[model samples]
Target: MRVSRLSVVVAAVVSAVVVVVGSEGAAVAGAGGAAAGGGGHEVDLAFHGDVTLRAGVVRVRFVPRNHGPSDLADATVRLRWSLPLVGVRRLPVGCLRSGGGGVLCRTGALEAGSLGEPVEIAARVAGRPAEVRVRIGTEWSGGAVDRNPRNNEQSVLALDTGDVYYF
Candidate 1:
């Protein structure tokens, strides 16, 4: 059998395409030999916080940390409470009220291996419940891809006994 150069090149191209397609969701290393997403900079933001509910009032204190090799221009964090909000007493500088039981906050440009500004929010929930479930997650990360999302999302159950519950 005789082989042509054009045929060989075409075969190689098809093989490359197939390989790339097959590894779509697989853990493949990037161009720089790092196991990031699509060879782009990875930004991982982990949130640590504590919440206390007392006398129908809820207080939250949290800090975000970047654990990746890249810096993000900005990031958004979302907090949701199980009960509806009756009133907002205080919110961080870049934080805003969202809906009835949610708050969204923006963390200005965060560098890798650095901690963002501490956030504090105080609000009142409608009626009095024995406990409230608070969920924290990353809303946005400057369009960067995060490989590990488990650390960025957290959930906590805070009782009205005024004890701080850490997430």
Candidate 2:
């Protein structure tokens, strides 16, 4: 059989289209070129409840949802708390890994424990701050310990409640 110029062009176009379609669902690589997941998988984390520090014990909690294909690991939580009446001060909460199917964190404490009330609590991950109001109350009595020694900085999300709150 003889092939015409028009037939050749059509064949080429069809081949190109097939290649493009086949590669449409290609997997995306993560930090270390690891096959992260499909194009539609995503991870979403959010803070739902209030964090309360009482009786020398600090309690912190959150809700983390894995909307992505791969699980998140070693996610760091940065916390900054200050009182409106008092001057600005930065409280360091350290980095913590994820647990319980990428849901919560129970990291250590940034400050020992205080008998005062913190006016504001700001929690951040991947440099983005959470949209909820972090409530700090010292109903407990625990000594404040500095965890961040490199820059004399403590982990941004440390509380007696847990090592690292994942959600």
Candidate 3:
């Protein structure tokens, strides 16, 4: 059977409409899946270091914040010093040696959009070592996804017994 010109035109228009509608539906479905996967569980970390220097001594308070839609559990913090500071001690977080003048501590659950309790670390200047620098960051935990990993680490110059701070 020979097809008429009008019938051919109608068929082409209907085909085009079906293809466009199908594509839109697929796009919507994919967006819905992504939203469900996120589930307000995206977590991000931000680090803040407070350094105190006085009389050949240094103290660092490492505060990490969870900028998240949900709370985080068992997050870890790491602190590293440039100098081989003597008399180093970690209070309350049970941090252990991480080699090369570094310490690590595990935090309890961090509330959503909250700053964690500061981890206190102090050390004595070892016979006029080089300028003190402290670097602090968060360690990854299982099943928790951090949306912004770049802000998880921070470094600061210790403000104690140095030309920068004291005379």
Q: Which residue window of length 10 is worst by lDDT in model 1?
A: 25-34
lDDT of 1 at 157: 88
lDDT of 3 by residue, 1-167 (tens): 99999999999999999999999876655544435663334577777666766766677766778887667776777877776657775456557767757778876777778987767777775665445777777765535667687787777775445433311
* Candidate 1 lDDT over residue span 1-167, tens digit each: 99999999999999999888877634333432234434356888899989999988889889999987787779999999999989998687899988989999998888999999999998898899888888999998756778789999998889999999987
lDDT of each: 0.85, 0.31, 0.69
How much does each candidate deviate from the true structure in C-alpha RMSD?
7.2, 16.5, 10.8
Question: How many residue pairs clash per model?
Answer: 0, 32, 1
Model 2 ranges with Cα > 4 A deviation: 1-42, 52-59, 84-167
RMSD of 1: 7.2
- Scored against the true structure, residue 119 in model 3 reaches a CA lDDT of 73
Q: In candidate 2, what are the lDDT values of residues 1-167, reduced to their tens digit? A: 99999999999999999888766534222322224333322223222333543322333443222222333332233333321212112332432222311112323222212111222332332222232223222211121211222321222343444343432
Worst 10 residues of 3 by lDDT: 158-167
TM-score of every candidate relative to the true structure: 0.78, 0.25, 0.64
Q: lDDT of candidate 3 vs native?
A: 0.69
Error of 1 at 80 (Å): 0.4
Ranking, lDDT, top scorer first? 1, 3, 2
| Root-mean-square deviation of candidate 2 | 16.5
Evaluate model 3: give its TM-score: 0.64
